[model samples]
Target chain A: MSGAVEIAGVGLHRFGRFDGTSVVDLGLVAVRAALADAGLRRGGFQAAYCGTVYSGVAAGHKVLTALGLTGVPIVNVEAGCASGAAALDLGVGAIRSGRYDCVLVFGMEKMPAGIIRSSFFEPWREEAGLAVTPAYFALRAQRLMRESGVTREMLADVSVKNHRNGVHNPDAMFRKEFSVEQVLSSALVCDPLTLFMMCSPNEGAAAVVLRRGGRGGVEIAASALRSHLPGSVLGEHTPLSGLIDDTAPPPTSLAARAAFEEAGLGPGDLDLCEVQDTDSARELNSYEELGLCGVGEAGPYYAAGHTQMGGALPVNASGGLLSKGEPLGASALGGIVELYRQLRGEAGARQVDGARVGLAHTVGRGANASVVILKR
Target chain B: MSASRPVRDGLFRDCGDGTARLLGARCADCARYHFPRAEVCPYCSCDSCSAADLGPRGRLWLYTAVLRPPPGYRGVVPFGFGVVDLEEGVRIVARLTEGDPARLRSGQPMLLVVEHLHDDDGTRVETYAFAAAEEG
Candidate 1:
C-alpha cells in the first residue's frame, strides 16, 4: 500500500459489433480517449501494456504505431477473458516498482462468431463435443441448482436485473430490457440456460492510464491475479484439467483473498461491485466465490434484492458483460473502467450513489482470475 | 455399416466383448488418477505414473444437452455431455448416451460403452460414452 498507484484516467469504445472496424481502430479510439482524459500529452507515459486473445501478434504495438505513440516499452499479455485485467496488473506492478511514473494499459478483441473455439483443448475433444463452453456452463448450472437450491427462475432474475440496468448504459451493446418470462423463454442454448442468459462474445476496447503517487483520482488499492490449482474438477476451472476435489478453492476465491489482504479491506467495505457475468449463473457463483455472500447462500442473497441497483451494494451497474457483450481482452478492463467512473461520480444514470470503494473481478479461459480493488 | 473405430487411440478400448473401460494413468507417488492417461502426474508433479483401467462404472455428477453442435463438431446436434465421478476417484468429462435432460439424473449409476459418433468420409467414427445403468 505504500507505493500507491491511481487510475489517472479511463476510456472505452462502445461495446458492440462494427462490421468494418479493425481491431486497431477499436484500440486507437480507447487509448486516445484515455490519454486525453489523463491530461497527458505525448511522452507522458513511460510504458504500455496491451491484453488481447484473438487480436493476433503485436496487437499493442499496432495500436501505438497507429497513434505514433511507439518507442516506450510495449508489451502484450493474454489470459483468455482476463486479458485486460492481466495487462492492468502488469502496468500497476510497473508503476508500483517505480519503473515508470505513468503507463498505459488497454485491451481489445474482435471475437469470432458462433461458439468460442479455443485451441486450449485438443481436436479430439472438440470433435467429441466435450469442449463446448455453454455445455460446461450448463453442467455447472445443474450442479449449482442441486447444491444451492438455485432455481431456473433465479437464473432468469439475474438476466432481468442486469439487462434492466443495461437500459441506462448508453455504451452497452444490448440496451433493451427483458422480463423474467422473456429471459427464460428465449432460445435454449443448453439445458437450464437460455441464449439470453449468456453474454454475447462481441467486440469492444477499454483503456486505463495509471500514474504513480496520484491524488483525487481513483486509487488502485489492489490488483491480484491467480491461476487455477490442480485437482478442482467441480470448480469453475477449465473442464478436464484435474480430478474432483471440492476442497480446493477456485481461482476467483484465491484472487479475492489476495486482493482483500492487499487492500486491507474486505467485501463489506465495498460500496458496489462489477463481477463477471459471462452467464447469469456465473454472476451468482461469483457472489459466493468473492465472499459477497456465504457459500451456497448466493441464491437467497440475490433473491433478497441486495445486488440490484439502489440496493445495499449494487453489482454490475454498468450493465455487465451480459449487456455489453464480452470482447475478451476488454472484458476485465471494462469492469475497471466502470468502477473508475462510478468512484469518480461520473457514471450518469447507472451511478451507485456515494460510491467510494469498488471491486472488479474477471475469470478467463486459462482458469485465471483477477480481482482489482479501487477506492476514492 | 461402414468400418467403425475409436475416434482416438489409447483413450478407451473395447474389452472384445460388449464392455468398454477408460484407459487412465495413476500416480505412483500420490495415487491420484487421471483420465485420457498422463505421462506425469499433475497432482504430485512426478513422472511415476502407470497406465490403469478406470473401471466401467461411475456415478453421474452432472449433465447437459447441447442444443446445437459446437464449432468443428460433426456429431449429431443436441448431444449430451456430462461429468462422471468414476469409482476410481477420478472425475472426467465425457459424452453421454442420453441427450434429453429428463432421462438424465445426477448420482445415477453409469456404465462405459463405445458408441457411434458420426460418419467421417464413408467411415463411422466411434467414441466412448457413458450410458445410464438400469436400476432395480
Candidate 2:
C-alpha cells in the first residue's frame, strides 16, 4: 500500500470515571502520550481534528489550548460514538487529499448522568421522553429474542465473557469480573437488558497520531462511515421501512465490503476484531452483520466461545466498551488502541498471538456507523 | 426520579430561555429558513446563522409509550416518544402527546401544534409538539 496513510502512534490514559478531571484534561494526557509514542514533535502537525459530544463549544480548542498549540486549524467533530472514527477520517482525508501530511485525531468525553442527553437530540424530544438508549437496545433485544432462541441468560453470558476480558486490560475502569448469574441480576436499565449488558457511560480520551509520508507502527487499510437517511434502506426512526435484509447480510456487511475493497483485504484476513457492543444484543447483532457467523448464530457461537481469544476470531480482546466501561466519543478509539496493542505484539494476557490485521467498528445513537481497518 | 421541573411553556425551555425554540434558527446567510435552528445552515456552515421561526407543518414517523425512563429525566409516568418528519425534510424525535396509541402506526401523519408538554405545577407550560394528523 504505497499511498496508505499510517498510524504512527496511539495513546490512551487509564480508562475510568473522572469526577474531577475535565474532558479537555483527559484529552491532553492521551495526546501527549501518543505524541511521545510516535516520536514526533507535537508542533509538526499541520491541522487538528477533535471529536467530542458533551464537552461543549470550542471543546477542541479548549484541549489544544492546554497544550499551547496555537495558530493551527482545529475542527470539532461530533457523531456520537463514531466521533473519534469520524475525526480520524477527517485527518486521513486531509492527508490523502494532499492538503497535509500529518494530523492529530482524538476523542474526549465526560459523560453526564440521567440519559446522557445527546447533543444531537432536540430538547422537545427529551422533554417528551423519546430518547432512551437502553430502551432502544431493549427493543432490538426483545425482537432478537423473539426471533432467535437466545435468552436473557445468554445475554448475561456476553457480559460475563467481556468482563473476563476486561480483567486483562490494565487501564479498564471496571476490571472486576462478574459471573453469568451476577450479570443476570445486575440493575435493570431497560427491560431485557441489565445494567451489566448495557455499557455504563464514563470519561476518558483515546488518540491516534496519523502521518502521510512516514512509515508507522500500523497501516490504516481502510475506513468508512454512513448515516441513516429517511426513505433510505431501513432508516431507524422510520418504522415504515425494515432493515435492508432480514435473513442475513447485515447493513454493516456493506460497510465491511467497502472497507475490505478499499484495503484490498477480506474478513478471512483479519486476526481479531472489535465491534460496537454498546449493548450485549448489539454484539450478537454484530456477529451476523460483520459476517463473523450467520444470523441467529451469534448466540451459539458466543456460548461456544468462538469469540474468545485463541478462537476463530478473538473479539473485544481488550475488554470492549461493554467490559472496559463506556466512554462515548473515546470508546471507538479505545478499541483502536486495543487493536494497536495487539498488532504491536505488546498485549499482555488477552493478546491474540501473531495477529496481523484488525478492524474496529463503531456505531452511534443517531443510527450512524463507521468501520476502520488497520494492519501491522 | 430526577428533580421535578415546573411546567414550562412556549415550545422549548429545556435548552435555554426564549433565545431557542423547540425548532427555530435563522440562516446566517440568505436567511431562507431552518428549524431546530442550527448553529450553522443546512446550506452553509456560518456562525452568522441566526434564529428563525419554524412555521408549523409536519407528521409523525413512529412512537412508543415508555413505562420507565433511565434515571435523570423526571416527567409524568407512561409517556410516549415519537418521530416527527418536518415538511422541510428534516426528521426529528419528540414526545407523543396524550392520545389513543391505537391511532399511532408507521407513517401515520402529524402536524405541529402548541400545547402544554408538561406541568411543573398546576399552570400549564406550553411547548411546540407534534400531534398526529391527516395527510392533507
Q: Give the lowest summed-lDDT range of ten residues in model 1 chain B.
A: B1-10
Reference-based TM-score of each model: 0.98, 0.75
lDDT of 1 by residue, A1-376 (tens): 4699998888899899999999989998899899999997464899999999999989999999988889999999989888899999999999998888999999999987668988887898788877788888887788779877689999998998999999999889999999999999999999999999999999999999999865767899999999988777655456663566557788999999999999999989999999999999999989999999999888889988999998998999989999999999998999999999899899999999999999999997888999999999
TM-score of chain A of each: 0.98, 0.92
lDDT of 2 by residue, B1-136 (tens): 3344323333343434222235466565745444445576644456677654443556655454556653445566555555556555555555556443456665677655554445555545455556666677
DockQ of each: 0.72, 0.11
Model 1 chain A scores worst on lDDT over the 10 consecutive residues at A233-242
The sequence of per-residue lDDT tens digits that candidate 1 reaches over residues B101-129 is: 89988889998888888888888888888
Candidate 2 error regions (>4 Å) = A213-216, A231-251, B1-67, B70-136
lDDT of 2 by residue, A319-353 (tens): 88877766777888898888888999999988898
